[model samples]
Target: MNQKQLVVRHRLRELMVAHDIPSVQELSRRTGIYYATLLNFYHNKFNTFNNRTIATLCEFFDCRIDELIYLDKKELCGA
Candidate 1:
């Protein structure tokens, strides 16, 4: 049998480009999210999501959760 895993992905970069956002620092300043935190997410180096941060980003971007974060299903091999 094959196993599957759900990988989490974010569209911050894409959204930024589509919205004409120049840099992550500007986003953080406008959204009131910490620069470093947004930087981490911008680079996809985050291990977990912060609800408040997500909500703030959604509100700032006028977007929904599905538009921000999504899951990717992957199959894994067994030992």
Candidate 2:
């Protein structure tokens, strides 16, 4: 079976800039998410994350999933 490469483009940094959020630490506090987890998401270092986490982010930011994460197929395929 062939597996499709899926890349998650984290838009947290962009949102932070637009919203004037000081740091990931502040986001963590406001969202009740772990600082390290937020850092991982900010850096795109996490291989996998749970839906609950995503839900929390969406709720906190009042944004949809598309605004937070983008699925880049071209980058995944190296096109």
Candidate 3:
């Protein structure tokens, strides 16, 4: 199997919905991920997450690597 190419978008809102995280504001407090940045991330206004940020999200959600990231066709074009 081949590894999928990932887009540089963030999906914090989707994660919140799947995990029942109440609100971005609350999640921000809980994750210490910065309210405005997290909001921008969720809204697709921000692109890309830093290694440390990804690590923080994973650590907070107790999720494995695959659970945190995904690939879409647009991301595969250059790969």
Could you give me the TM-score of model 3 versus the true structure?
0.68
Per-residue lDDT of model 1, residues 1-79, tens digit only = 7788998999999899888889999998788899999999998899999999999989888999999999988889881
Worst 10 residues of 1 by lDDT: 70-79
Q: TM-score for all predictions?
A: 0.87, 0.81, 0.68
lDDT of 3 at 78: 40
In Å, residue 15's CA in model 3 sits off its true spot by 2.8
Flag clash pairs in model 1. none
The 0-to-1 C-alpha lDDT of every candidate, in the order given, reads 0.92, 0.84, 0.73
Relative to the unseen true structure, what is the C-alpha lDDT of residue 68 in candidate 3, on a scale of 0 to 100? 68
Give, for candidate 3, the lowest lDDT window spanning 10 residues.
70-79
The regions of model 1 sitting more than 4 angstroms off are: 77-79
- What would the C-alpha RMSD of candidate 3 be, to one decimal place? 5.0
Native-to-model Cα distance after best TM-score fit, residue 70 in candidate 2, in Å: 1.0
| C-alpha-based local distance difference test score of model 3 | 0.73
